[model samples]
Each structure stands twice: as C-alpha cells, then as structure tokens.
Target: MFSEWKFTAKEIAEKPDLFLSGHRACAGCAPATVLRLIMKAVRGPTIVTNATGCMEVVSSIYPYTSWAVPWIHTAFENAAANASGIESALKILKKKGKIKHEHVDVIALAGDGGTYDIGIQALSGAVERGHDFLYVLYDNEAYMNTGIQRSGGTPFGASTTTSPAGTVIPGKLQNKKPIADIMVAHEIPYVATASPFYWRDLITKARKGIEVDGPAFLHVFAPCPRGWRSDPAKSIELSRLAVETCIFPLWEAINGEYQLSTPSKVLALAPQKKKPVREYLKLQGRFRHLFTPKFEKLTEEIQRITDERWQRLLRKCGMT
Candidate 1:
C-alpha cells in the first residue's frame, strides 16, 4: 500500500547516525545494517532494550557503545519484559509531568535464539498486556554468538554445529517455526517480515510499528556470513536472492489483515516468476551438501517446503 514513498542512498546516508560505526560485525554484517535502517526511522528520542546476543556483544563493548540513544542491555530472555517495564514507567512519568517525553520510541531487540526460544514467553506477555512498543528480532537462523547452534528459526536441511550434515543425517530435520504467524495469532496491532536488502520497506515498517498504539513485531532477515559460511560481499545480494526465490517473503500482518509488502506484492502475482530455490541455496555453505548429486532427495525436500510456504503466504494475504 505504501509504494509511493521513495528513499535514496544519499538521503539515508545523510540521516542522523543513531548507530555509530567501528563495531565488531563481520565484513558485511547484515544485522548491523538492519539496525541502522531501523534506527533511521525514528530520529527523535528513543529508549532501546537489547537482549544478550551478537548485537549486544558487538555494539556495546565494555567501555563504549555505538548507540546514540538511551539503551539498556538486558538478559537474553527478559528484554521484552524489561522493555515493557520501561514503557510503563515512561507512561506514568509522562502522565505525572515528571518527564518531558513527547516522541520517545521504546524498542526491544533480540536475535533468533532470544526471540524464538528463550524470550518467547516474555514477548507474549508484553504484547498481551498491550504495551506500546516495538519488538524487533534479527533472525540469523542460529545462535551465532556462542556458536553456530541450531535455533527454532533455523530451516530444514541447513547444517549447524548441533545439527551437523553427516553420513547418517542430512542436516536439521525439522522445519522452521512460523513465529510471525504466532505473533499474528496474538491479535496485535501490527506484525511484519522485513529484509535489510529492502531498506525503504524496513524503515517504513519500523516507523509504523513505533507509531502504532499497541505492540508491534518485526522479524528481519539478516544474513550471517560467518554462520552461513557465505561470501562477505554477497550478504545483501543473498538477501535479495532470498526474497526473489520466495524462501523469505516480505509481508505484513496489520490488525489481522494480511498483505504482501512492496517488493513481495509485485512478485506474488506469479509464484513461478520467482527464482528457483537452488539459486538461493548454492550460495550458502550450510546448504552445500544439498547441491551434491547424492543429496538430490534432500534438495527436493527443501524445495517442497519452500513451495508450500510460498503458497501458504499467498493464501494468507488473499493473493490466491
């Protein structure tokens, strides 16, 4: 619906740098880029709660932090809870005229491990209580900080330290959990799936989620070069290929009404128009085993799931 809004590289570059440079992300850190785009959406005062993960470790080293706004480093499982408390306190302070908080945006950030597994309970509670804040999860498909261990967000047939691709087993045996759908089931005001490759959509979604009165969730697709064993320069390219292949769709569920985002809307017209899953799989080392002739069955299995997911999303958005 918001196709007319356009942003240029220069415009985004000139925006106030809420996330400073000189952090410990890899050469092409997609999560850091996603953070930058999200922060650009709201230039005013912001209070951020970050969970223990790659972002918190890299951005806020002991002596310094890249964040220009008021930030809190909470435990891995309670960022959402802490954010809820902070937001509630802000409301009371604003009501009592104790703090001059006009446009302060409260945000909770976590990784896939923190969001899908460790922090799901706190997230559910915060949203159910009708907190006015945005919860964003940068999904890298595994626990990237400690090690490359499989997470609930990990897709099938991808190899992690725990879910290794060996002689007996191919890779992770289970499909990824549909966390976005789970959030939608909560009947929240807004929930969205975004990718760092589409900065405009990411920024717009973050701004809308912040403006909404109720809780909002944004699941961002951020590629991990070290974890995925992919080329550093191809991170953004892989993200785009992921969307064009329908492996990761760009969509939003707003107030229980589902619709594809700008880029996804254009491609949803014809599922056949999207690139094949092989184009997306071959680039990642984690899926390299599936490309071999011996693992044809595994590759086909992954393709089957991809087709099913793409069609399901289409039906959900009423594009079918």
Candidate 2:
C-alpha cells in the first residue's frame, strides 16, 4: 500500500482530543504543553487522575472542564492512590466480563508539590506494587498554584515566598530533590527526566512510558512564568537552557538500565564545553538575588549543584 508508514491525515484526525483548549493556564506554562504532548502520545482509551494543584484547579473548574476523557481530581496528594484504585477496578471488571476492552490506560498527573513532598508515599506504593500506569510530575520548581511557596522540587538559590532571599538569608538553601533517581532506585519499569523545550524527545519518551507494562515515571521540567518571574514568552527558552546547562539533564532508566539522551550525551562527550549555569539562571527572577556581587557565593552554590548532579548522572550511566 503506502511506501512505508506515517501518521496519515486520517490517523491524525482519529486521535482523541483528550485535552481541550480554553483552560486557564498562564501564558507560556510548560506543564500545560506537557499535558498536550502526553495526551497526543497516548493513543488509546485513557483515564486521568489529577492531584489538586495548578493543572487540576485550572482544568476542572466548577460547571466546566477542559478534559475530553474520563478524568478525576482528588486531594493535593492522592492522585497515584486514585489511579491505582481505578486500574485495579478496571482489571477486576474486565476479568468478570463486566467491561469489554483491549486497553484501558490509567494516567496520574500532579505538580511537583504533590509528587515530591506530600504524595511521595502514595507514589512509592503504586510503583512498588507495579501498577500499569504513568505518573507524571510537572515540576515548576515551586508551589506555583499556591503562593509561590518553596517545595521539595525548588532548586537552590531560587527565591520563593517561603524561601526568600534577603540580607540575612539566600534563596533556597537546599538543592532540588532527586526525584527521578529515587524512582530509579525503586526499579520501576521506566523512569525519565524531560523538559518541554525538546518536544520531540518528550513525546517519544512519553509514548515509551505509556507502553511500559508496569510502572513508569516522568519528571518534566515545566517552567512557570508567574512563579519564576521570567518573560512569559521565554518559558521555552528557559526550558532549553536548563537542559543545555546540565541543570536538568535528559536521561532514562528502563528497568534499572540507564542511558543519557541527546543533551546529556553532549555534556558527557565534552564536559568542559557545556553551557554555563548562570546563562540559564539569569533568565528567571527567582534567581535574581544571586546576580549581585555579595551573592557570589550563591551563584557558586548553584553551579556546584548543577555540576555535581551532572557528574553523578554520568557515573550512574557509566558514561564517565
């Protein structure tokens, strides 16, 4: 028939519009774009469970919903638990001949707060039990849905409402939680770190994640214009810089086997040629405090964090 194979117009037309437009996401919100890309990648019957955060609050307002699929929203820290229950129920019903379906995919969505701080227990349990679902953490670095408070995902030297940068104290004193590494320690079927700047890479990884037979975790770097105080249009630029600087390396662990992606490969090939972390931090207001002369230590701290993380990743992947 066709010379090879491609996503024909008919096939594109047949893909479900799982996420609808007109939601209240801030301009240049990467997580919203992540949601779109993830939905496009998953091409089967799917149900979504959302933890209470920016995405859920915006997408499922009263008397309206931006979701085009079966979706449920729960408390700030229970999306994984809800998805686990839903997947279990679907399996039981299908076994008893109550429901006829070849595939029913379960997806759990949560912001960094829900994933890193409050919901880690639920996520760990779901992954340990090997639930057939995907857990995506849209890490905007702070609790953007609330008052721009600091969360476990917040990077060092970034000023937030709770972790203020003042004369006495620098921004956040701690580095971001190593979420992807934690998932890998669990030995999940798939664990990945991604950024919205690389849409094609993100989509490919998302497809692979959803197709995994057991648990999969995707930690996405989703920039927030409002919380980060960056130019709304620079969201994509910031995302790219994060990866290029090795502040957010792209990598994956499939059943404990690790491999670095494009950007990480470049870093590994020529570590000295990597982009400066300052070039990435200068774009965001959250890191503004680090630019001043007296805050030089903070800048060094941030760079140290980035380089250490990158080296650690290389070592784990055996690329060192």
Candidate 3:
C-alpha cells in the first residue's frame, strides 16, 4: 500500500511537514528532527502514541500541539501498550466497517528513559504479542526531559547528573544496554538503528517499520545538546561522527537476519575506514572528563568497548 511512498531527497524536501513548526524543542534537538522525518514517511492514516518525554512535553504543552496526525500522550512506561491497544481497536473497527481505511499505521514514540528502562516491559509484551505497530526509540542516552540523569542507554564513561564524573570514579560505569539487540531477540519482523544525520535512511527505515506485517522497532540516535553539553549547531556533525566512529552502527535486522546499513557497511568491511571514537567524543562535554590525565585510561577503555561492539555487529551482519 505504501510502495509509492518511496521518496527522493528533492521530493522529501518538497513534502509537507507532518510535524508542524512552532513548538518548544531545543534549538538543535535531534529527537525533534527524527520525529519530523518519521512523520514525513507516513503514507496513510496514522496514530501516534508518544511517551511522556521531551517531545511530548514540548510539542503538546496545554493549548498547543505540533502534531498534524492523531496523537496520544501516554505515560512514561506505556507508549507501546497504548499503541498496541490502538492497533487492536483499529482492527476491530475495520472488521465492523466503522472505519473506512483498511490500514492505519500505529507508531509508539519514546525516549531512552522510557524505552531502555521504564517502558521495556510494555514494549516487550506488545511485540511479543505480535501487534502490528512500530516502536521508535529516540535515544538521547539520558533522561534529558527531567534532567541529565543517566539511563540504561547511557554509554560507558559518559557523565550525567546521576552518574557524575568525580575523583573516585569516571562517568557512567555500565555500557549502553543493547536495546536493538534485545528487540531483535524478540524476533520482530523489522528492527533498525537510525540517526537524524541520515534523513533518507531514517525515513526509509521508518516506512519499512510501519509497513511491516508484525511489530517493528527503530532505535534512533538523537543528540541532546543541553544534556551532552555539545554545541547546538554541531548536532548533525556529531551524529555523522558517531556513525563514522562506529559508536552507533547503522544496521537492520529483518526476520532475524542482520545487515549493515549503507553508511556503516564500508566501515565494517574496512576497519581502517572507521574513525576513532575520540573524534566523536571530544565534541561533547559529557565525555570531557575522559580527556583529563587521571581519566585518560577510561577514554582508551571506551574506545576498546566501541571497537568490540562494532566488530560484534559486523559479525552479526556477516560483514566480517
């Protein structure tokens, strides 16, 4: 039904913005950009359930909304559950001839705090039940809506309010939870990682996720300027650097088969093509401490971890 939805860069540029302007997002909020891309990819009637996070708080502040489609604001831990219910209701309505549309895309949007921690169980249950919907995780790596508190998605050695870098310890001690892998383990029909820097790829993945027959998951890397203490204008640059550094590999799993996305495919095949993680980390204040003499070794550890993870992904994609 959505075959005609495929779009060229110029076409996408000319398309109407489903995520309208004049809302309260940060100056260079990548998550806000991700939302716009996702909405632009929709080719039919869609219902969006957004978790209580930055996007929700900013877009839907009482008496105002940025969404052009039907949108529901759900609790922090139940965006998936809400989308599941919406899908089920759509099915029932269609069966009863109450709704004219045969297919209405259902999308659940959440942040790292909601997806990796609070909403994981709900998301797991929804996908396990094989609901026909899409779950998009806009991971800024911390609870940026409330404060820069560390979440399960926070990378190792990254400082946050809850995991501050101090004399005794470096930033967050634990590595980022592999939420995409966890979704793949659920055996969903489609699972992918995206970044706002690659708008076409992100839009393609969003379309695929929505068009899939069963549940789909998208883990999008959204740079948080306020939380990461990075320059607002460099958000897109940081996103690109993340992919080049293999800090966030672009890849997708379709029906249990993994394949590296175009941007990261060359990096996987040619290890030397991958930039050093430091190139990506140095721009963000959250990782500034890692540059200090006392915490320099922690930076090396982070590099080791990133390389290992990239290698693991290459193997999974059968590129290594």
Better of 1 and 3 by TM-score: 3
lDDT of all predictions: 0.90, 0.88, 0.93
Q: Which residue window of length 10 is worst by lDDT in model 3?
A: 1-10
Model 2, 134-236: lDDT tens digits are 8999999999999799999999888999999999788898888999999999988899988888876787777778888989999999999999999999999
Could you tell which candidate, 1 or 2, scores higher by lDDT? 1
Ranking by TM-score: 3, 1, 2
Instruction: Encode model 3's per-residue lDDT on 145-256: one tens digit a residue.
Output: 9999999999999999999999888899999999999999999889999999988899999999999898999999999999999999999999999999999999999998
Q: Which lDDT tens digits does candidate 1 get at residues 89-207? A: 99989989999867578999999999999999999999999998999999999999988999999999999999998877888999999999999999999999999888888998998
Q: Model 1 TM-score?
A: 0.96
Best by TM-score: 3
Q: Give candidate 3's whole-model lDDT.
A: 0.93
Q: TM-scores, in order shown?
A: 0.96, 0.95, 0.98
